[model samples]
Target: FINFPVFFSGVSMLIVVGVALDTSAQIESHLIERRYEGFLASGRLKGRYVR
Candidate 1:
C-alpha cells in the first residue's frame, strides 16, 4: 500500500526547491540587468555561489 503522508512530504519538498530556484533565477536576472558585476562584492553572494 502507498503511504500518502510520506509521498506528500516528498512532493512538498520538491515544490519548495522549485520555488526557490525560480526566485533565485529572477533575482539573478534582475542583478544582471542592473549592469553590476554579478555580485562579486564583499559579503555579497551570487545565484551560482549560493547554489
Candidate 2:
C-alpha cells in the first residue's frame, strides 16, 4: 500500500509535464507566426502559418 502512493505520484507528474510541454509548443508556434507576420506584411507568410 505504501508503494501505491509513490507510483501514482510519478504517473501524475509525468502526465502533467506532458500536457505542459504540448501547451508550450502551441504557444511557441503562435509567437513564431506573429514574428513572421511582423517581418513580412505580404502574403509570403501565409504558406507557413497554420490555423
Candidate 3:
C-alpha cells in the first residue's frame, strides 16, 4: 500500500542526506587546510552519525 512508497522515500532521503553530509565534511576539511572558514563558524562539521 502507501506504506511501501513511504518507506522507500524515507530510505532514499536518508541516503541523499548521508551523501550530502559526507561530501560537506570533506569540503570543510579541505577548506580548513587552506585557512578558509567552513559551513560553521567554529569549523567543526559532525558526521551524519555520532562517532
Candidate 4:
C-alpha cells in the first residue's frame, strides 16, 4: 500500500520527532540546572516560559 514517497515521509517525520525530543531534553536539563523546580517534573518543562 505504501510507495517510495510515503516511506520517505514517514522516515522524515521520525527524524523530526527525534530532533525535537533531543532539543527539548537539553533545554529541560538546562532549566533544571538553573534550579527551576516544578510540579510536573516529567520533562514537560515548557511551563517555565509561562511564568
Instruction: List TM-scores for all candidates, in order.
Output: 0.53, 0.58, 0.50, 0.52
Candidate numbers, best lDDT first, in rank order: 2, 4, 1, 3
Instruction: Please write out the lDDT profile of model 3 over residues 1-51, one tens digit for every residue.
Output: 455554568779889899999999999988787664444455555565555
The regions of model 1 sitting more than 4 angstroms off are 1-8, 36-51
| Residue 28, candidate 4: alpha-carbon lDDT | 92
**Number of the candidate with higher lDDT, 1 or 2:** 2
Give the per-residue lDDT digits (tens) of candidate 4, residues 1-51: 755665578779889899999999999998887765553565666647653
Model 2: per-residue Cα lDDT over 1-51, one tens digit each? 355555568778899899999999999999999988886877465559666
Q: Which structure is stronger by TM-score: 3 or 4?
A: 4
Q: For candidate 1, what is the TM-score?
A: 0.53
Local distance difference test, each candidate: 0.75, 0.83, 0.74, 0.77
Model with the higher TM-score, candidate 2 or 3: 2
TM-score: which is higher, 1 or 3? 1
TM-score ranking, best first: 2, 1, 4, 3
Per-residue CA lDDT of candidate 1, range 1-51, in tens? 665765578779889899999999999998786656544454475454663
Give me the displacement of residue 20 in model 1, in angstroms: 0.3
- lDDT, residue 48, candidate 4: 75
lDDT of 3 at 9: 87
- Record all residue pairs in model 3 with backbone atoms less than 3 Å apart, i.e. clashing: none
Clashes of each: 0, 0, 0, 0
